[model samples]
Target: MKTINNSSKALLATMLTVLAMAFSTTTQADGHAKPGDFTRGANVWRDNCGRCHNIRDARELRDDQWYSTAFHMRMRGGLTGQETRDVIAFLTSSNKPARKPIITDAKAPTASSKASKLSGKAVYNQTCIACHGADGKGTLPGAPDFSSAKGPLSQTDDILVKHVTDGFQSPGSPMAMPAKGGNTALTDADIRAVVKYLRSFSK
Candidate 1:
């Protein structure tokens, strides 16, 4: 009876050990982004999508427009379906501008005041015209013409800002836009002003 009791105790101990190992493995796996992990979506965007497009601010497109653009780019850009979805989820969720409080005070600048005062033409001349041309037509192989009717500027201020800040590398383009036009110092306000300026040139 003593031997049998010892054997049962050993078996129970083994079972507990197995269970513990299984639980540990699961916990570790959860710590990382799985194929479906939206939590890791931002990282994925930074790694993969950020190479070509801005990923931080959402002033570019409305949520619905982002959905379509992401899906189309996923196919043309060779992103896996899961990766595309992850990036889309990140952009749609985190890129929007914050809503301002309603205030009756006369001192508050209207929403338009929040818009940057810098001229798009000045910003372009200072930074972009070398690569994109004075007309906002891209001069280099990888650069895109902002004047193109089909370009992102035709969308909205929100969409343009998001794209500019995130950076984008189209498949055929040899060079990609660096985040914030390769001027890391450019503030979000600067990018918005540039977007507004570029839209003025669009057909």
Candidate 2:
């Protein structure tokens, strides 16, 4: 009984040590997030992080702590690249002291600029690749295959865009695509870019 107890305690200590090391490594690896990804991160937090716990207020952690915690959670949650950056952005941005925005009267971009600025492939990779797949052949069981002639891409651009923006449950499919592909930060142009990317597979 004494030997058994010692073994159990040793195992527990080893596990704890490994965990601490992992956390430390993750914190260091995450570093600081760049700006502009905060809105995307907010959406990621709501969609993914909310699954396990009440969405903690981002202000709950200081900047350094947020980086560590977000990085740790990212490893556990399987977030990568921009998704991780975005979450960190959301947390760190929220940690800032709140203040009213300085308003400036500026005209919106012209149509040509908006069209050129967004990349369909980048948007698709960031938002849709999780479910829809890197090959346009969905990871989810019922995710529509963009490469298929009779798939979602077969629909008119208007119909596809509407379905994507508003979210869609295929007629007989088990999984439902989330609204704005779960990234509410995505602009209308972003959605169109994703659609264009998907359509590329058909060509």
Question: Total clashing residue pairs per candidate?
Answer: 17, 0
RMSD of 1: 13.8
lDDT of 1: 0.61
Please, what is the whole-model Cα lDDT of each candidate in the order they appear? 0.61, 0.69
lDDT of 1 at 165: 74
lDDT digits (tens) for residues 66-136 of candidate 2 = 77787788788888756777887666655554222254224444342355366998888677775676798
Q: How much is 157 displaced in model 2, in angstroms? A: 0.5
For candidate 2, give the lDDT.
0.69
| Local accuracy of candidate 1 as per-residue lDDT tens digits, 94-157 | 4443333377236665534355556766766655564566777765555676777786555667
The candidate that achieves the highest TM-score relative to the unseen native structure = 2
TM-scores for all candidates: the values are 0.41, 0.53
The reply for model 1, stretches above 4 Å from the true place, is 1-117
